[model samples]
Target: MSLGLRTLWGWTRRLFPWVLAAIVLGLVARQARMVEWAEVWVAVQSLAVSQLALAAALAALSYALYASFDLVGRHLTRARVSVGRSLGTAAISYAFNLNFGSLVGGLAMRLRLYTRWGLSAPTVGKIIAYSMVTNWLGYLWIAGAVLIWAPPRLSQEWLPGALVLRGAGVALVLAAAAYVVLCFVSRRRQLSLRGHSMELPSGPLALLQATLGGASWLLIAAIVWTLFAGRVDYPDVLGALLLAAVAGVLTHVPAGLGVLEAVFAASLASDRLPVTEVLAVVLVYRATYYLMPLVLALPAYGWSEVAARRRSARAQAVGDAPV
Candidate 1:
C-alpha cells in the first residue's frame, strides 16, 4: 500500500471504534425511548441473590476458559513460560481486550507481558494468530450447530427466510471443517502469507482447540442464560449470543460496548421477554463478565509492572556496586 493509504488505514482503524460506539448508542437510545426505565430498573433489582451468585461463578469459569486460549497457544508455539504467568497474562490481556479494542488493547497487553516473560516478538505474534484462530474456530462450531439444530427467529426485516440461515450455518461449518482438513493434509503444517509464515498446530491440537473454544463459548452463553433465570431456553439464548458476539466483533468497537446490547435486544424482542428486560440482563452480564475482569486485571497488571521495575533496579544497583 502507498504511504498515504497506510496512514489513512491507521487513522480509520483508530476512529472506527468511536464511530461504532456512537452508532450503537444511537440505536440503544431509540430502543430506550420505547421502554419505561422504571420497569427495567425494577427487573434488574429483582434478580435474586442466588441468581447473582450463580452468574458470578459462571463468570469465573468463563474467564478460566479464556485463559486456556493462551495455554493452547503456548503449547502450539512451544513457548516456555510458567503456568501461573501464562494464565495471568491471558486473563489480564483478555480483560483489557474485553474493555478496550482487542487490536489496540488486548494485543498490546499480550505483547508486553509475553515479551517480559522472554518470548520473541515473532513468537508472540504467532501465539496471537493461533489464539484468534482457536477462538473463531469455536465460534463457527457453536454458531453452525445452533443455526442447524435450533435456529432462532430473526427479524424479518433483516433475514428474509429460514433458508438463508441454514445456508449460512452450512457455510460456517464447512469453513471450520476446511481448516481441520488443511491441518491434517499439510505435511509441513504451516502456511505462509505476505512473506510471513504461520505454523499450524497438530491435528490433535486443532481438535482440542475446537473443543475448548466451543466449550468456552458455551460457558459464556450459559453465563448470560443464567442471568435470565431460565426465562429463555438455552438454545435460543445461545443462538442470539453467538449472533450478537459476531456482530460486536465485526463492528471493531471496544468490548463491542453498545453494539452487543443493541444486537441482543433486537434478536430477543418478543412478548415473553421484552427488549427492556433483555437489555437489563445484558447490562448485568457485561458488568459481571467484562468490567469486573478489567477491574481486577488492571490492578494485578500494575502490581506486576511495579514489581518488575523494582527488581530490575535492584539488580542494576548490585551489578554496579564495587566488590
Candidate 2:
C-alpha cells in the first residue's frame, strides 16, 4: 500500500470505534421515538440473578481455557517462564484485550508482562502470534461447521444466499485444514512475510491450538446463551456470537461498547425474541464476560508484576553469591 492509503487505513481503524458508537447511539435515538425505553429497561430487569451467576461461572472457565493459548506460545518459544506465571499473564492480558483494545491488551499488556519475566521482545512476539493463530484458527473451524450444518436464521437478508454461505464454510474448513497439513509437512516451520518471521508449531500442537480456540468460542457462546435464557436455539446463539465477534474486531470498539447490542439486536431478534430483550441479554453478557474479567485482571496483573520482580531479585542475589 502507498503512504497515503496506509495513512488513511490507519486513521480509519483508529476512528471507527467512535464512529460505530455514534452510529449506534444515533440509531438508538431514532428507535427511541418508536420503541418504549421503559419496556427495554423492564426486560433487562426481568433477567434472573441465577442466570447472571451461571454466565459468570462460564466466563471464568472460558478465561481459564484461553490462558492455555499462551502456554502453547511459551512452548513454541521455549521461554523459561514458569507455567503459573505464563497462565496468569495470559489471563490478565486476555481480559484486558476484551475490555480495552488489542493495542493495550494484546500487544502492550503481553509485552509488559513477558518482558518483566525476562523474555526478549522477539520471544514475546512469538508467544502472541501463537496465541492469536490458535484463537482465529479455532474460530474458523467452529464457525465453518456451524455455518455449514446449522446456519442461524437471520431476520435480515443482509448477507448473500444460503448456498454462498455454505460455500464459504467449506472454504473456511479447507483453509484451516491446509494450515495443519503445512505444519505437518514443512521442514522449516518459520515463514518470513514483510520482514516478520512467524514460527508455526508442530502439526499436533497446531491441532491443540485449534481445539483450545474452538472450546473457548463455545464457552463464550454458552455464556451469552445462558444470559439470553434460551430465547434462541444454541446454534442461533453461536452464530450471533460469531457475527458479533467479527463486528467487534472490525469496529475495534472498546469492550464492544455498542457493537454487541447492535449486532445481536439486529441479527438475533425475531418475532419470538424481541430486540429489546436481545439488547438486554447482551448488556448482561458484557457485564459477566467483559467487565468482571477486567476487574479481576487488575489484581492478577499486579501480583504477576510483583512476583516477577521478586524472582529477578533472587536470581541476581544467587549470581552475586557464586564463587
Candidate 3:
C-alpha cells in the first residue's frame, strides 16, 4: 500500500508485457534456428581494438544526439540554464529512456528540469512536442533514402518486398511531417483531446526547432551505422543500417531490443545474407550500441538519483524550518 510499493508494482506491470514479448520472440528465434550460439560467441571475441575504438566514437555520437534536447529546450524557453546543466539533464533522460521504455519518461524528466529553471509549463510542453517532431522527421529522412536507394542491392524477385517497404517508409515520413505542420499552423487553436487541453505549436519557430531536432537524430543514426558496419557482418551498410534504425524507432521496446534485431536479421536475411553473418552482425551491434550504453548509464543514473534526493531533502527541510 505504500507509495514505494506502488511505484514498484507499476513498473513491474508495465514491464511484464514487454518481457513476455521478448520471451516469445526468443523462443521463435530458437525454433527457427535464427540464433547460432557459436556465431554469437565468435562475434564477441573477434571484435578488434579498432572496432572497440569505433564503438566508443559511436557512443560519443549517440550522446551528442541526446544533448540536442537540452540545447533546444533552453533555446526555446530562452531560460538561463547553463549548457552543462542541459547536458546533465540530457544524460539523465538517456538513462531514463533506456530503462523506462519510452521517451515519455525521459521527456517528463527534461520538462521537470526546465520547470526548476523557471520555464513556463506550456512552453515546456511546446518544446517537448516540437522536439519529438524533430527527431521523427530526421528518422523519416533516412528511411526515405533507404527505401529508394536500397532495393537495387536486393534480388529482382524481391521487387515487391522492396516496393512495399519503400511505400511504408514514405508514408511514415509524410505523416510525421504533416503532424508537425498541423500543430504549427493551428497553434492558436485551443482544443480538447478527451478533456485534456491541447496547445498547438503552429509557428515558424516551431518548424525550425523540429527541423533541428530531426537533424540531431540523423547524426545519431550515422554514429550507430558507422560503428555497426565495422562491428557486424552485414554487407550493405547504408540499407541495412537504415532498416535497423527504423526498427529501433518502431519497436518502442526499451532500447529497441527485439525490433532492432528482428529487422536487422530480416533486412540482411532478405538479401540472402548468411544466418551466421547475420547473427554476428546483430550481436556486435547490440553489444556496442545497447549493452555498453546501459552499463555506463547505470552509474550515471545512480548519481543523478542521489543528487535529486539530496535536493528534495534540502528543499523539504528549508520549507519546514520557516516560521
Candidate 4:
C-alpha cells in the first residue's frame, strides 16, 4: 500500500467506530421519537417480579456462556492467561460490545486488555478471530435448524420464496458441516489469505467451539422467550431473533440500536401480539441484556486499565533506577 493510502486507511480505522456510533445515535434518537415512553414504562412496571427475576437469571447465564467464547479462544490460541482473567476479559469486552457494537466495543476492548496481559498483537488477533468464528458457527447452526423446522412466517416476505428459506437453511448447515470436515481432513489446519497465514483449531477444539457458541445462542433465545412469557412459541421467537440479530450486525450500528427494534417489531409482531407489546418486550430485553452489563462493565474496565498502566510505569521506573 502507498504511504498516503496507508495513512488514510489508518485514520479511517481509528475514526470508523466514532462515526458509526454517531450514526447509530442519530438513528436511535429517531426511533425513540416514535416510541411511547410512558407506555413502555407502564409495561415494564407491570411485569411480574418473578418473571423479571427469571429474565435476569437467564441473561446472566447467557453472558456466562458468552464468556466461554474467550475461554475457548484462549485455549485455541494457547494464551497463558488464567481462566478467571479470561472470563473477566470476555465479560467486560462483551458488555462493551453489546452496547458499543463490535469494532470499537468488543475488538478494541479485547485488544487493549489482552495486550496488557502480555499477549502479543498476533495472539490477541487470533483470539478475536477464533471467538468471532465460534459465535457465528453457533448462530448458523441454530438459525439453520429453526428455519428448516419451524420457518418463521416473516421469511416469506424477507426472502424470495419459501423454498429459498429452506435452501438457505440447508446451505448454512452444510457450510457448518464443511468446517467440521475441514478440521478433520486437513492435518496442517491452516488457511493462507492475502499474505496472511491463519491456523484453524483442531477438530476437537472446533467442535467445542461450535457447541459452546451454539449453547450461548440457545440460552440467549431462552432469555428472549422467557421475557415474552409464552406470548409466542420458542421456535418462532428464536428464528425472529436470529434474523433480527443478523440485520442488526449488518447495519454496523452501535448495539444495533434502532435496526434491531425495527426488524423485531416487523418480524415478531402479529394479530395476537401487537407491535406495541413486542416493542415493550424488546425494550426490556435490551435494557436488561445490553445496558445493564455496560453500566457495570465500564467502571470495572477502567480500573483494570488504570491498574495495568500503573504496573507498567512501576516496572519501567524500576528498570531505569541505578542499582
Enumerate residue pairs that collide in model 1. Answer: none
lDDT of 4 by residue, 1-323 (tens): 99999999999998987775565455546656776767767776767777778988999888888888887768867898989988889899999988887877678999989888999988888888888889999888878888788777763435456677888889888888788779878978787777777687788887887898889888888877888899889887788789778767656767877777766766788889876777888888888899888888989998997999899999999999999
Where does candidate 3 stray beyond 4 Å?
1-32, 77-80, 107-125, 151-160, 169-217, 228-238, 241-252, 269-273, 312-323
TM-score ranking, high to low: 1, 4, 2, 3
**lDDT of all predictions:** 0.84, 0.84, 0.61, 0.81
Q: How many times do residue backbones clash in model 3?
A: 2
Candidate 1's displacement at residue 169, Å, is 0.4
> What is the per-residue lDDT of model 1 for residues 154-191, given as tens digits with 9 covering 90 to 100?
76743447777888889989888888888878898778
Estimate candidate 3's alpha-carbon lDDT, on a 0 to 1 scale. 0.61
TM-score of 3: 0.68
TM-score of candidate 4 relative to the true fold: 0.86
Prediction RMSDs, each to the true structure: 4.1, 4.0, 8.4, 5.7
What C-alpha lDDT does candidate 4 achieve relative to the native structure? 0.81
- Candidate 1 residue 266 C-alpha distance from true site, Å: 1.5
- Across 132-236, the per-residue lDDT of candidate 2 in tens digits comes to 899999999898998899876653333556787788889988888989888999999897878998887898988888889999999999999888887688888
What is the Cα-based lDDT of residue 97 in candidate 2?
A: 93
Give the better candidate number (2 or 3) by TM-score. 2
